[model samples]
Target: MEPFALTVALPIFGLIALFCLPSRIANRRAKLVRNLVTTVVGVECLFALSLTVGLAVKGVPSQSIKLIEVWRDLGLNLDVFVDGAASLMLMLVSFVGFVVSRFSIRFLDGERLQGRYFRWLGFTIGAVSLMVVAGNLLLFFLAWVATSFGLHQLLLHYRHRAAAHRAAWTKFAISRFGDALLIGALALTYYAFGTFELTELFSRARDLATSASQVTASHVAIGWLLVLGAVTKSAQFPFHTWLPDTMETPTPVSALMHAGIVNAGGYLIIRMSPLVALAPTAMISLAVIGAFTACFAGVVMMTQTSVKRSLAYSTIAQMGFMMLQCGCGAFSAAMLHILAHSLYKAHAFLGSGSVVSQALATTGAKSPQPSPHLSLAYLLGAAAISAFAYAAVSSAFDVNVVTKPGGVILALVVCLALTTWGWRLLSVGEITTMLLGMTGISGLCLAYTASYLAVSHWLQATTPLFAIPPTPRFVLLAIALAFCALFWLHFVVIRRVRPNWLNSLRVHAANGFYIDTVYRRLLTPLARS
Candidate 1:
């Protein structure tokens, strides 16, 4: 067996063994199962480590390695092909799985559901392992679906806890919605290009010999749809709210999803980047959404009280940053951040549980808030992101990047100065200052999105056919100056919005639109009928 196959196969085998083992021996059974699980997971981790070593030594050597046949005559097969990105993700998944398993041992000490829990856990690992290495889109899709199933089960691991059960189903339902979108995209992929091989599809997509299903189904359309698949899976933008709420699952599950599987979306974008490049709109969309989501989630994190929820929001924000990197053509750097953050985030969540567990074990009840220094540190860290986003976007201010030197700088100063100053005001109970900070953050989000869209279009030199003709430079300058006036006018609205502005923003934010409400209104009665 190929080295990669060993990594993928071990998890499958472990899950099989876990489920097959009888559940009646009490402590004797748990201990035996624990030992066996440790051994299997340990072996899996080694295989991943070996692949990583091999990659580092030899650098992403791809070979055609057959793993299974999902179909016979229809040209469907499960092939695991190793690339630099896939190897890295597998290592991350396996490493996290090892840690979570170790934690599970101590945390789940006498839990009767250990067998089922490990089974789902192993299955999730197996699916993600296959997913990251899948050479074909169909195989990748299968693994994607399998990964979702594992997540669904993992979320429901504490079936007795209604919140746990509810979170599991919520995750399942949201994931299913994405699944439908992905299935459609896969169908379109196959229909557009006859073969499901992801590599071949990208190679042929630019010069399609096949007819499109619709005249309007151009390169941009397919790219947009595929990106929709990516965003939904990766949990970008509008697709994001689901991820933050998913913390109802055990902390371990959150770690795995955010640190490992969430990055899968990024991996997909990178793997299919060639095809994505052909669809500039998709890239730009990602850039804009990623930018806003990163900033939005990061800011929201500051408001959160739950430690896990804070991390969850942080994951959302960071994922947006990764997407922005991808949009801006800084893939290698994005991968580095993903790698570093995965370790840190997993450690943070696991450590949190350990702290909570220890606290309860000793003095009982909830632990106190983090020191004021820590709180201030988090706020300052958030304020500084306006600068980081500014810097990252500033490095290559293309149309594809969402941050403009001007816009990003403005947002940065406005957000940081306002937020920091607002903190001072809030310290002295200045509601006006607090509201100003709130409005500043909101404005920054919109500005970030606009920058994202412009950058995306810039990357591919996409010009809107209906765009207004450009005026003379001096004429444009006059308009630009006029816009400066308009910007302040908008700021004035933000200024006057008052202390209770968040309450109004809440209505917009809560309904997640009036957009969500509109969507519900449109979809709800139709579904009921």
Candidate 2:
């Protein structure tokens, strides 16, 4: 067996082995179970890391290894695909599993269900690891469903809590809907291409792109189905209610779901970029939905009083942004976003207790607010500095901010964010502070451009870089203007510029525009049944 293949297979065999331990015995010897879990996860993490490092050094192209042939006629087989994306995801999931396992050991020290928790946790991790390396749509779909089942068990660990049950059921329902969409996509893929293997499917897609063959209706249907499936799993718009309500689960579970499982949606789109990019209408729909979800959740995140709930909304917003990146054909940026957001959210959730304590410690104190009286000239200057910094860094990395798909819009967002930060410092009215802020902004832009380029290079072999359907100039302008308006609102809110309309808007935003309430009402009859 190839080293990469062995590394990918180890976690699936080792972690799933935990399920073989008798429940009665496991509960009796909880400490032993914990030790076993830690050791297995730690070793798996090391192996995954080495595989990724080796891939990076050798710059291996994507390859698929067949492990078993279940049914040749149906194109059903067990296979593992090795590529930069899979290697990176394997390392990420394994490392996160190991950390969470260690954290759970002390966190659930006296819990009655500690052994069961570890068992399900390992199962969930194994399922995710398998999904990451699955070479065919059939195997990927199986692993996807398995992951949800494992997570369902983990969520119900606190069976005594009514809220926990409600959240878990809601999630199960949504996941099933996503599963249906994926099933539709799978059928359409087979109908259109006559193959379940990813490598062959991608090859066909590339051929169609380069040839004069017109994309058929099945291709469009598959694209839309995939978009629907991804949105549901990632908790976009109305489907995101369950995530924030899931605080009843343990912190480790929450961390795993937010940091790892939630990322599956983005990964799906990135993995199938060649196919998804074929249907411009589907891509447009994805971009619109993603942008709306990001803006909506970002507003709601500010009104949340609970730290965990805040983080949950933050995850939704981040996921939305990542989806937007995918819809824009920036698969590498989306991949980078997943990696960064996962690490950050995991740290945020695991350290939430300390965060709450620190917040309470400084409850009575108020931090300095940006001055509302700053001149418009100063704001313009800040924007100029931000744009200049981004352009300079992007040029150094040989990135075309104008012609690249969604490049201009993404650059605009980055500039807006940096401008806001610089504007705040400028409002402080300190020359030294303004200079330091500009320097920090430049450094951040440099790092952001460099990281994006590196990820793009790494994933170049796996992801397709076809010409994206051109977004209309008017549409791009509208998006830019909307972001600008949002920036102005954020500025006003932070400056304490309270008005009756602003207050009214805040109330609505705080309740997430009551979207979740409507969903609950609709689902109430079914739940009662």
Candidate 3:
């Protein structure tokens, strides 16, 4: 088998091996099960690393291999495809799997269902790995559903806890709804293109793009269906009630769900960017919805008192931002976001307990309150410095921030983030601190620009270069203004200004605007039946 083929096959086989472990061995030899699962995951990680290195050296654009012919007539075949996006996702999932498995061994020690936990964990990881590398829509759909089911089991590890059961059931319901949407999208895709194979579909889509052929209603439907599916899976607003409520699950399960599973929605959009971009309406919808979710979740995250709940909302906000990047046709940035967010969320989830303990141990200090004049000056200075730094780094890297898709807005977003950091640092009122903070911000800007350039290069072959949307300048200006307002509001809240309306808003934000309550009320009758 080719190296790429072997890498894809390993996960499926590992999943089988895990399920085939005897009940007696699993129940009695927990340590052995732990070692076996860890070793398998570790080896998978190594394979992913080697695959990435190999691809880099050879510069192979993309490769598709049929692993099994389940039913040719029905377009149901097991296939594996590798490209920049797949390779990146594979490496991320494998590394996170290995780490989480190792962590679980210690965390779940002496638990009665330790062996069962390892089995499901391995299955979930394998399923996700396979999903990322799937070559055909059918294979991808199967793996997607399999991952959900496997995770469902893992979420129910504490079967006796009613809250765990409720969360799991809620997730299951949402996932099934997503599955339906995906199925509709896949069917429409086959109807329009007459192929489930990704390579052929992409080729045909590109042909449509290059030709004067108008997009049909089926194409538009496929795009809408896909966006709906992705939003549900990624816990976008109105369907995100399950995530924060899932704190009853084991920590490892939470880690995997946030770090790996939640990213599936963004991955789907990136993988199918060629087709999805055909519908401007869909793309615009994604941007609007994603922007709303991010803003909504960001505010809610700030008001969360529980550490885990806070992280849960943070994941929602990050996923929303990622989706927004995709909707803006910034596929490369979206992919980069996935990779960075995955690593950060994994660590955040795994170390959440330690984080809470440390927070309690440390005494909180009031932030220094500089005079209003000095504060305004510092803010303005930070904004200027951030913009200059970003522009310089982008120019150094030979990147045209203005011409790229969603370039201007994303660049400004980065600048805004840096400005916030700088402003906070400057407020510290120490020369040494200001110098160090500026240095750190400079390094971060350089690193971010470099990473974005590299990701764009890697995805050049696989992803389509989307044309800038209509009224790009207008869109950029509007978004920039909105972000500035948000930043101002953040400071106002922090300083406890306008306690009357602000307190009311905080209550609404903390309750997620009662969206989840409405969902539960609507579903109560059906759930009872």
Candidate 4:
């Protein structure tokens, strides 16, 4: 079998088999079910790994293989496009699917919906896998719809739960809106370029961008439509409330959704980088909305009492950050962020049960505050260390990817990381332990930066570096500074009791700034009346 067909078809066949098995058979043969899922997903992961490794060794091959042809005159075909970004996403989906499937073997043991759960789980994985590899817009849309339908089933697994049903419906509503935008985008692409193939569209897009005067209304409309779809898919701003409510779903489903499905927006933006680079208006909109959502969700995350809810908000903020990277024309950084966030969020969701115990352990523990002079020293130390580390890593890796918004935003994140470590060390009473912790944190940060840069370098083909516009540059910097300030404030609010004014803000934050209330109020009356 061809590599693409093998990778895409295996999971699909697995899904079919899972669906065919009767619930009683799956329940009675639980071990067999576990083995089947593990083997199928594990093989998919291996196939993805092989493809990725081949890319590294072969130096970014332009490999496209058609799986099937759906139309002749329209030029629509089910083709697989294998690039660094696609490879990374495939590996991520497969590995996460395998891990979540294995985990669910025990996590959801004896649940009545075990067979049904596996069926949807398998279907979602297969659908997502196909979506990432799609070479034609038609196939991409089909896979996209499949994932949405499968996810809705998974979200409403507990059919009797009102909250779950409500959350599912909200998600479904948002998804349809996004789908409409995507369909419009596809239609525009076909109208403009006369083909649904990515390679053809990208070639024409390059020509259009080069002849800046040739760019037209359709180009701008298509770009905005794609971004709008991505914004809804990633759950930014107004669409974000549904994500937090989705905690009513199963843990594995939450992991898959947050870790894999939610990253679809970033993936879409990156995959269409050629076209996105041409639309300054769309990019600016992405930056503005993404920045606000990141800050908003970050603040709200701090006030969330429930661990799962906090994680949900955290995903929103991370997705916003990813979108911000895209807006900055930091597609490579966005890809890295997607990969890192997926792994981190998956682990966080799967192990969320231990959060209560961890919280209990830290309940009465007092953190030591440094004197003014000492605090100043720590802050200076953190800034110096972070700057030095960033410079060294960038220089060593030859990552001259220091473009406007992405570079500054990345620096802010580094500053936050080092400063948080500095605070932690200040609370440590032992000098030796503090020094050791500082050294360890610095080293880990260096390693992470280097690895990210290396991956960014490899994925450069899929995401060509682009520069942000002048006005958006200033706006992005402001957003970056706001996030840094918000980060510091979050640290403060979490460690101390809030005052009266701050308590009001906390209530607002806890209620997600009343956005959901407004949504319900506006929609509910229309439904009833």
Better of 2 and 4 by TM-score: 2
Residues 157-249 of candidate 3: C-alpha lDDT, one tens digit per residue? 898887777778888899999999999998899899888999988887777766536678898898899899999999998789989988988
Q: What's the TM-score of each model vs. the native?
A: 0.67, 0.95, 0.95, 0.92
Residue 155 of model 4, lDDT score: 97
- Report the alpha-carbon TM-score of model 2 versus the true structure: 0.95
Candidate 1: RMSD over Cα atoms? 9.9
lDDT of 2 by residue, 1-529 (tens): 2666866687687777776777677778888888888888888888888888788777777888888899988988888888889888888898898899999999999988898888888888988989898999989999899999989988988988877777888888899999999999999999999999999988888777765357888988998999999999999987999899889999999999999999999999988888887777898778777877887787888778889999999999889888878877778889999999999999999999899688788787454664444456668889999999998888888899787878888898889889989887777678898899999999999989889888888898778756777766776676677777777888677777789998899898888789878767766555444
RMSD to truth, every model: 9.9, 2.0, 2.1, 2.7
Q: Put down candidate 1 lDDT per residue, 1-529, tens digits, no spaces.
A: 3755556665645554443444454234666666666666777778877876775565444454766777876567777766556666777877887888788777777777776666666677767777877878888888888888878878877667755654555456557787887787778777767777755665575444233342246455566766777787787776665576566676677778888888877877766665565565567667667767765665456556677777877888788877766664445545655777799888888888567677667874433344556546645644554445444444544433223322332333335544444343334334675466545554554565454543333222111111111222353244334434433333333333434665564444434343234334444443333
Which residue runs does candidate 4 get wrong by more than 4 Å? 1-8, 13-34, 359-367, 371-373, 400-405, 465-471, 494-497, 522-529
Per the 3 Å backbone cut-off, how many clashing residue pairs does candidate 2 have? 0
- Residue-level lDDT of model 4, residues 1-529, one tens digit each, is 2554456665655664565677677667766666777778888888888888877777764456777788889998878888788888999999999999999888888887787778778878888888898888778888888889989989988888777877888788889999999999999988888998987877788778767799888888888988999999999998987899887799999999999999888888998888777788898889788888998999999888898999999999999989988887777778888988999999999999998898798888566766657765766676676667666666776655354446767667766767677666654557886677567666866777777777777786676433435435578668878877886676666447467888888888889988987666554443233
Q: Can you tell me which runs of candidate 2 are displaced by over 4 Å?
A: 17-22, 359-371, 375-378, 525-529
